[model samples]
Target: MSDISDFLNHLPADRARTAFDLVHYMLGKALKSEDADEVLTEMAERIGRAGVPLDRATSIVPLLHAEAVASARFWERGSGARSYLFPYTPESGDGYAHSPAAVVHETGEWVRLWLPETPDDTYGIVPELKEAGYTDYLMAPVFMKSGMAGTFSFATRAPNGFSDEDLAFLRLVFPALAGAQDILATTRAMQEVMRMYVGAEPQRRILSGDVHRGEVMRIRSAILFADMRRFTELTVDMSAEEATQLLNAYYDCIVPPIEEAGGEVLKFIGDGILAIFRAEGAGNVACFKAIQAAQEGLDRVAHRNGSPSFDVGIALHLGEVAYGNVGSGLRLDYTVIGRDVNLAARVAGLCGTLGEPLLVSDTFRGRIADAGKKTSGGPVSVWSVGVHALKGLHTPLEVFAVAVP
Candidate 1:
């Protein structure tokens, strides 16, 4: 035992191998003395795979199995018994039999309890514990941000069960497990934040025409173009920082509804946002969502800046066009490129030309009407381009506008 102690006392000869050996020994140790060691092992493996620190990971489990094993090899003259880690509960004997410990739900907090020994306690013991000739248990709880994540329980076959030293060690290890839970929570939160922006890259490349996807596959979709009205003039009077801050605030107001409606914002060129609603896949639901998103965006922007009003012009077009990843392999963007796309943009630009807040192409109006929906928001009208020939189009298109409601 002293020799083993001496070997571990010095710096590890091989870091990776030492870490591996440490974990293996710990698992074996957990298995030997504890009847419920397998559960702890599963937890340890999960934490390890997540790249959590061993100390932090251990803090979350029944016991830091690895640490227990090392301590056993050093302090206990004889070795090879595993440690059992579980939360303490009243039904099981304080000595060691924590019955029904396997399925007990826990809050993410450490709790200590003394189990009262009784013949009636038989029902609570995990069936496997009885099969393994075990009869007593002790345990502790590990907490997480959401709630009690799990428990660590220890069991023994001895009638007299665990001692003061056993309970003390487990209590000492509880803090470590809690730390690991916090680390995992923070890691997950950061990952979720990253996922939001990272997924948009592929679509960005497709829209930018940096990457090609075997020629553009034309499909019917709802095209949306929104631009901040008089943005150039508005920003010219403000400082760069103020301008940037206002733009960001405006984006914050606009983005929520778009994302909520399952629309993808492809690009933000200057003060305009080009969004696409993949209508074919989600059907009318997608179209409605896009419209809802636009409405929400308008409302949010209006509320964000009150009194001295800031207005946005939006145009929607429903049409078939070449849409997909179109560009060199170096870069690509998932976007639509065709007469319909152009028409939508032209309509958006026309919002400024007509001094209207919202405008929609006849194509968009026709689709919504076919779906049994009425077009609202035009009590206050603007120059309605009744029917005019749009450049590069085979036929004339009708356009209308409404005030910034």
Candidate 2:
């Protein structure tokens, strides 16, 4: 490892001051920009303007997200900036382990190699870049106070490769770039976590400072309530890991179709899922979307069933709901609460007793009729299942069962 002090000692005072001023300006601009791509583009421009013969620059930052482990790459070739997300899995570990960025990450130090002189077996990526006409390559780790480390790799096609002065100047300005990266990474992580737990719109609303308990908004929506049939009995004898896997499989079947139909899954209540499709203008578009999602869910569940079948019971209702934050001061949940939400849940409970896979409220059926929107399943028949007293209600509630042909 080369001593950082050696590089610092050789840096001229005038050059050092210029680097400092440039980094200061970059950091100030980064603080004001929320877009990561813009920040990276500006950094690349600044580096090129500093008299370095830069051909390409790449930044690899780890992120917190489902299906992705630790790397998102930003590449700048000339003036254009592009980014790619690398999803990590156990099967993909080998490729990352052998990468040059991995060496910098593991050592927590700089990995500088003269591409023209590097041996074929020295590293996995260097030989390729050398063949592509790169003379110098440097990979450095960017450490943040948050303990997350990112990487910056600079490449040049300049015949003589990077000078000691160029490396020294980079060492001085890297901390400022890393600081700005930390801020962006933190914000992105928070957004990812919030969107994963709560629905997307709810996450945005909560982040925008709508946190007071009992603060509610009345909006019309097509509500869906779905639960796995006999989930308790099925999981009673299974191990904890087995139960979790079973639940995830059920969600895999339930979530995608709803999301594909432009519905937001609000919450998971044990084995049950609550989702909504909010309509922007007139017409029963929300109702149409909810029914389409329910049909897709039924089809997916049927396809997922094996020798011993796993089934689901789904109910759809359309009405106004109170969407907001509700709970104690210390603990709060952002979800929907209203009579319509309760009625949807109660309707879902009747699926097993009524011997039907899917049910819809009379109000929902009326909205479909009023809007003249045909079911996506193409001319399916529906039958009135007689008004019956729901558990918590005094008045008899009429329900309809969709007969899939």
Candidate 3:
């Protein structure tokens, strides 16, 4: 026998039998030239009677992930996130055998072999399965930029059990498994984005020429509204080209601070921006982040103008808002709505009336204090516009302001 064949031949009766069973199982399930050739005459007859085409990767990958997950349950069911356990790395100075080579190989690859017990038998592709309380294991990688993704891993409880032949067979199977998984993930994400921009799902089914829309999700957040104090009048004096250049310069100065403050610029209305803060953890974090972000915006524009020419009014408020697809499906605007949103706009509007460049709603201000932030001032208000009703709102809101802080 050849070296590879000889290695296979040495397997014990049971292992050898299982190995053959595995080969046959894969051959029958996964279409291949070799398998089809063996039953050519039978295949022809079967095809003549009834034909079945294989489904594409999109349908198949979910099934494969499910199968791997089911198999992992044989070892231990109900483990939170990770169903399959890997070879445990020993603590320093512990009795468990620590092999750097094995550790490096497992960490670097798209596939890994977990032998939980064998501390020393880590050199081979299949780690010492018996010592690690693992009989057979198959691992597939999930490439996600953040946290964990789909991991298809299975394990058995047997000794020196999963041999070279079994390992080689799995290696061949893994590529197809990984590819199908990747295709499904990419397709699902793209489909979600497509659904967002195309409006109705039916519209997306028909159009293939347009840009795939980005998915937007609603979340409770702090809203920041900033506008040029005198943009409408200031631009009238400048030439069209000069106005455009100035606007672009202003955007450059303002955008970075919002981003640095963990805000997404939801819209650029003429010479203003509406940004949402969704990066804060909880509590009044969102409001505090908006305050810091507004400060950053002021500093950036101040530096850019040298003589502080570009005057910007910033306002912040906290409330739940309808924060998803805003524009036509063809051109999306991911923005926010509701009382907090209106309040932010009103606060921005007040920058002119109050003669202060920064203003934050009492709700936003209260949240900042509730989050343990120390600030000096209370109800230093010029207007108590008794619950002035906004255009879209049902109830008039009780609005107050601290023009400067």
Candidate 4:
């Protein structure tokens, strides 16, 4: 307490007051902001207005995602702010190893370079900043509650660079800034995890206040249900790690095409994937997109197939589904349940029994025919696989096989 008091007492009176106001803002309004980019842009401008001549500011934090490693936001005086996500690098952690942020992470301390005054050959960005008239660059560490270090960096075009008072004031305000940033980042990370495990549509609905148990929404969509063939038999002799690897490999082929075709993957039931395509009131358009996605997914699986290769059965149908929260207490699950979903799954069973990789319900085919528009990969055609009685269902379903081009 005494050390902090002395540090505060040593600051110029005006700078002390500025620092206090900025810290208060950091602890208050900044944490309430939706995302880090908004907070960083406003804070940079606010601090500059408060007598810190910063021309640029950046916020970097570790991201919780399957495809991305970390996220960075770059803020400039005139250009506002832009966000960038670094993908997972198979070798090292991308080009970040040679970055100033990495040095701060390694030493748990700040790194400041007096721009052009210092040799710029050590880092490529230094020369670029110097050329852009930046005279000072500082990277400070922000220790997050997750036991990882984030960073806030600043740059200035001021001729004399940042004053000693500027550094002191920033040092005083950093704890509050760290708290605000960590709070926002943690919330974002949780949202990312939600999207990863439960999928995008479910995450959006759940976070948008559709969270009450038994709460459901009746939605009309084209359903696509697919499962790996011989999953149990193939995995029976393999280790857990191998089976997981195989499933992930298969999903990589399946999930991407669904997403690319404007469909949402709702769940991964063991080796099975349940996805939906909706065009609001247009069931034909939804069926068209679902058909395209299924075709592309099979092509992808075929392309990615190799040693110990596997096959998949895909089913398409169109109807209403109950989309929303289920289960009880803290164990709530946001998913879809309806006759159409069941029909889609039942059609998937026909894929194996009928010896076809792709099967569609009669309702699905009718919708596609209504679409009438020329679909890619030639005009869509199907072969009648004939109706067959499926387990747990009273009426026999008429299933058709998607003819391979």
Q: What is the C-alpha lDDT of each candidate?
A: 0.53, 0.80, 0.52, 0.84
By lDDT, the candidates rank as 4, 2, 1, 3
Q: So what's the TM-score on candidate 3? A: 0.42
Please give each candidate's TM-score.
Answer: 0.49, 0.90, 0.42, 0.86
Off by over 4 Å in 3: 1-217, 279-282, 306-308, 326-335, 372-405
Give the Å error, residue 147, model 4.
3.7
Tell me how far the alpha carbon of residue 162 in candidate 4 is from the true structure, in angstroms, after superposition: 2.3
Query: How accurate locally is residue 198 in candidate 2, as Cα lDDT from 0 to 100?
Result: 83
- The digit string of per-residue lDDT tens for model 3 on 1-405 reads 334456455554554444445445334543433332223222222212221110101111121121121111122322212123232334421321243322323574533444554344454434444544554455455453322244444454544544454454444334444443454444544554444343332234334433344444345788888988888677777889888888877877777877886776766778878778763555376676677777777777777853327788887778655544455667764444566677778768767765667776656766766554344322233334345555566766555553433
Ranking by TM-score: 2, 4, 1, 3
lDDT winner: 4
Which residue pairs in candidate 2 collide? none
Tell me the tens digit of each residue's lDDT in model 4 across 84-112: 98888694464677678888888988899
| Highest TM-score against the true fold, candidate | 2
